[model samples]
Target: MTEAAAPRTPGSPCWVSLLVHGMGTTQDFYADLFGWEFVPGPDQLGPYVRALIGGKEVAGIGQLPPDRHLQVAWTTYLASDDVDLTAEAVRSCGGTVAVGPLDAGESGEAGRMAIAADPGGAVFGIWEAAAHLGTALAGAPGTPVWNELVTRETSTVCKFYQTVFGYEAEAEVSADFDYQTLRLDGRPVASLHGVGHALPRDRGPHWMTYFEVADTDEAARRVVELGGQVLHPPRDGASGRVATVADPEGAAFAIVRSTTAG
Candidate 1:
């Protein structure tokens, strides 16, 4: 694969998603983080959990079958009224279409999506909103307001997204990091990019969730107390401090308190 900067349609991101390992983890982790309340849906698709930050529904977590291999992780799901059309666009755009406009079951009707790499190895999900409009949470401390991509090839991924979601990448991202923003319907929705060499080998391609926190140090410590592991300590960044972590089952995610609103 040729290497180049994967530029995305410059703007802000739209929405993100939360993936989980098991049901209890899908419940317990965010409950401590966002003070979420449980809402029962059809007992079959399982319970739908809503996280409340400042007394408003900010994010959500739900259980999935073990085979999905998607433990508990946050994925920024961009809005889409037509997932099938988007999937087709993904194929025409030179990106690998991993999933579909297939049935995601009563999660309020979502067009399922998964894509890879930039200049072509980071994997993230695209949720074409149906009944669910996305996380109720905004830029509240301890809730998710932003989702960033850490990948290898940044440019190829940009083309894939532009073709898949009608997004564009920015030209500048500070020498410290590279970034590509996903835009849809002429509005910013999510982001794409390459950062660390952690992709391709350790975890394959995946979307990581970043939860808003007041203090990264304290939050990382709490993760340890709650059966989660602190994979990396809190580090300084333009977005304040962030710590890489995993749930009880070892599903990875991050916690951040940004300087600007996410």
Candidate 2:
């Protein structure tokens, strides 16, 4: 299982947030779909709502600024000890800083954070946990179970992240699939997949957040019923039955029922 306890190690994906145009609608959709409860976040986290599962914070919803070209997407945040230092490391490793290494919440409420993109343009965040350590629940319904990057420039991204976060990757899945498991302290924390050939030519690099479900097929059906689109039908993979889906606003994500010890 992809069950994670507290005290996330640096380089591990510790939080996820959805940036959307219609904040209320998106919040309602996820709340209905995943049985999550929504609550206002810290004052400094303006317009950002906290998503709770079983009354514990598991995810976040932040409003996308109008007139911005940024698309609605789920961003995975990696645990970092020093946001400024990590941002510098990101630049040194060929990635670009998209946003701040600035304060996230009220004075010393949560830690600092920064948004950055890999060389391939896949966006992710780095969080320095203070009073607010991210996502306390995992490996269950309604919470993120795994984070993966699907990119065209796989080699460049792999090397950049390895340099920035000291990640150790093992490509034991298979040559044809080109899947590498990223590990921190010898434990699997995330993955990288080269899916350029499978995606549309115009599709750019992006990080995919996968949520664990009780049944992938049922979740796929419900996704369609809820006005979302199913990008990939349920199919058996080495990890478990999985399906790709997009919310009504076109933010893509995946659902999985793990059969292996992920």
Which has the greatest lDDT? 2
TM-score of each: 0.75, 0.94
Question: Which ranges in model 1 have alpha carbons more than 4 Å from their true place?
Answer: 1-21, 42-48, 66-72, 96-100, 103-123, 173-177, 181-189
TM-score, structure 1 vs. true: 0.75
Q: What is the C-alpha lDDT of each candidate?
A: 0.59, 0.85
- What is the alpha-carbon lDDT for the whole of candidate 1? 0.59
The parts of candidate 2 lying over 4 Å away from their true place are: 1-5, 43-45, 260-262
Task: Give the C-alpha miss distance for residue 98 in model 2, angstroms.
Answer: 1.2
lDDT of 2 at 28: 80
Best by TM-score: 2
* C-alpha-based local distance difference test score of model 2: 0.85
